[model samples]
Target: MRTAVVFPGLMVCVALLAGCTATAPSRVRVDQAEGGLPNCKTFAWIPTPQQPATLTEQRVKTEVLAKLKEKGYSEAEKADCRVTYVLDVHERPKNKPSVGVGAGGGSGGIGGGIGVSLPIGKRNEQAGTFTIDIVDAAKNAQVWSGSLDATFAKAELNEDEAREIVAKVLERYPDRAPN
Candidate 1:
């Protein structure tokens, strides 16, 4: 029937679209202290040891600040909570197998041969982990932490992309300041 043919074509189109729009794989994890998040609404950035000094760091910082503001938190010199972020990037080991095809013919006869493929080289892809931590200023201990691990084809990220990553991680945070 016409409906059956069209349905299969539409399904194929949908599958192709999905493949085209695939996003990088990412995982998010959150940890909280025994007492849970403090009811503090203000935050200050504490220096992270060996933090990467790069343009990407600046972009991430900007996005984090924006997200915090959106969550009704403000920055202050003497805030009740302190915050910090770390970005780490490294190359992932390649584990993909190669693919191949073979065809052959002989004069006055038919012949066939089998071939196996072995990968010669691989493209190096980098994976990055972004982590944000909140600490209670009075107690000087961590209150809550969120971490995102993502595989990337490139190292640089624009503002919107950076915002997307930060937003995904911060989505786990309370909708409003914790009480």
Candidate 2:
């Protein structure tokens, strides 16, 4: 009975430790004009001329559009509001050096141990910032913006992940009533 409990407890501890290695916490920030978002029911996506559209861009746009629609907003050729999004990724070296130490001892007779410490190669990390800006079409000025920053181990971005990130960021958007 004691063995069974001990084995299960050890497995639980190991599982908990494994889960602790998940991705780092992400940061989100939102800023809106004093009067809050416009009462417009329609909006359009405006692409930046400087940066050409990419796969990730297209995926995020689609996800955001769906989310907006779910909130009673529609897409129109010429609408009361314009939406533009930006995704920026930067690579930086993790200044912290990796160190490893190991020791082994002989089992029988006189036991002796040897230890070694070595510095491992530097690891590269990728950080990304996703921002969405909502502007008043007639005024040509931004009314609200939301951004999310996160550090990731993988350099490549996937559609599903982008969709999830965009959804989380857009959660800050104020809901609009049917118009």
Candidate 3:
């Protein structure tokens, strides 16, 4: 009897934790080592019209800047390397949890649940893909290119989450800087 009531609560906690531990962005496979990306840490942000419904061009810029700065990248019009990133987002899975009423409020049948509509199972998988390309002013071609995928709670509410995701995407640079 007691176990019956505690089991569901325990399960719900597990589901929420799983959602947060989903995935981190990825690194682009590039050739070369040493003398690739400069240590100046100069990066910029560029948004596309086809981006996710979660943010506006202005907000994305703000978020990206914050993320980069948080990672120790300074804001400058010019630096050793030119970094520009484009954001693309697509909607994947959106799961709504159908919670049946368990044993609650004296409504004793199977049980009762809360009125919240949050999904208990899988959620709508929203992805934020960033295309970061570094251009060498001396050479007209792109020197480095990287992409990152981030899953968000909702497609429309992306501003807050973008900071964390974009920062993570750029975090790869510290390790991937050409061998």
Candidate 4:
């Protein structure tokens, strides 16, 4: 009896841990114009309409800036390309446990057992997508884009962790700015 109860609890714990262990982003995608990208050595931030300034946004911008610099792009008032990002975060339903109650009787005696179905997969957690776009400032057309989907363990992300995620998404970008 103890083993049955303990085993279910242990399985629950393992499932929760498995969900928490998903730190890397998935569904990464990148798109660029057919003619490749325009020669852009400098970039400027283009405000995303309706996006309020927030800590998460700030962290993303900071990390993106650093990554762009590393890739030979600099921010300036007059730039060859414009940069912007969109973040979409929404709650995702986790696999929930189910409980079933039933009654049974046998000719020898009456017997019953309660059964519970426990979720052994993703627990209730938040998932989100981060997308970055680079547009030609003069032509007002997008040149390149990168995006990643991730399951966030927490509602809020610290700077360091956010940096790592941003870096991963940016990995799809060119190694250096287009000349």
Candidate 5:
């Protein structure tokens, strides 16, 4: 009847909606130096010894550079400021019941209960943490830092996702003063 048709249609709609839904980034942690953010218009990227030059790193750097430029900052080899970033990924297991039970009964003097348990495909979760730091060239110390953590169902971060994350993290950056 109408119930049968409506139920399946509703389920389909729900599935489509879930697939199209976008997850929001988690809480961000921001720290400013004791003297507050330094005043600088040019920046250079200084990679850590442990972090090699990789495609992901390059993409993140590009996105961050674009954002900084949009904020009226320029990149320079001997600039007043330096920028560095880090990206980390971790895997976690999803929480789920290990066992399940089912019961059944019939009116014709028949009743029975069944319990079944089986190993389902492992459902692992992944999370990524991104951090950006800015240092004052004259002070030789970090002036500001921002970090964001988000969970994902996949192991790798796509370019779009990485750009979005970088944008979200940089949203906390302080605005530059008028020249």
Candidate 6:
């Protein structure tokens, strides 16, 4: 009984103390960079609140670089073509989506307080922000750049998940290059 009662507190504790980072698409929709190439691609990423611009950032960068290299955009610009990508990461605060429940049979006299909500529905109020960014690596300026948001689950990231998500987001990159 006591453990059950402590569940809510624990949930709240995790929600408030533990950092929840969800990765979404990109942010920058427009590009201001000058110069154009048909085959060059550049990239830079900004870290999220949970993960700052550090070693973890390098991991993310390396992933992007690998993908770009694989796509054959690493030397796109050198060939006097068009290709460039500017990326960044950022985060914001969000209310935990949650649900609620309450058992009342007879009368009541100010049951709970404001913050103390008795969930009557599913827990859909787990508040947490996301870590995402915008990737622009199109022809002239921005041929591809979008935002991304994700939730935090693993302290150490799994490469498979990272690649899949990044690939999914890039799938929607603007088509300035030859189709």
lDDT of 4 at 11: 55
Off by over 4 Å in 6: 1-53, 75-143, 154-161, 174-179
Residue-pair clashes per prediction, in order, are: 0, 0, 14, 0, 0, 54
Candidate 2 local lDDT, 43-156, one digit each (tens): 898746787777777788899899999888899989899998877888877654333322323333233233444446777688888899999888888999999996655555
Tens-digit lDDT track of model 1 for 1-179: 11211245545655675576556666789999988788878888886568666777788888888898899898898998888887687887544543333333445443333455565677777778888888999999998999999766667766776888889989898856455
Per-prediction TM-score, please? 0.67, 0.68, 0.47, 0.67, 0.69, 0.37
Model 5 misplaced regions, further than 4 Å? 1-25, 48-52, 95-119, 153-155
Cand. 1 Cα-lDDT: 0.76
**Candidates ranked by lDDT:** 4, 5, 1, 2, 3, 6
Which candidate leads the pack in lDDT? 4
Model 1 vs. true fold: TM: 0.67
Q: How far is candidate 5 from the true structure (C-alpha RMSD, Å)?
A: 8.5
Query: For model 2, what is the error of residue 129's alpha carbon versus the real structure, in angstroms, after optimal superposition?
Result: 1.4
lDDT of each: 0.76, 0.75, 0.57, 0.79, 0.76, 0.41
1-179, model 3: which lDDT tens digit per residue? 33333467856765775666565545544432356654546654332468554344556567656665666666666554565666676876567544433334233334445444665665557677766666654454466675766666765445666566555655665532332
Candidate 4 — what's its lDDT? 0.79
User: Could you tell me how far off, in angstroms, the CA of residue 63 lies in candidate 6 after the best superposition?
Assistant: 1.1
Mind giving the per-residue lDDT tens digits that candidate 5 earns over 1-179? Answer: 11212245545655665565445647889999998877798989874678566767777889999999988899999989999887788887665433332233344332333344554787778877889999999989999999998875565666787789889888989667779
> Where does candidate 4 stray beyond 4 Å?
1-27, 48-52, 96-116, 119-123, 177-179
What is candidate 4's TM-score against the reference?
A: 0.67
User: Model 3 lDDT vs. the true structure?
Assistant: 0.57
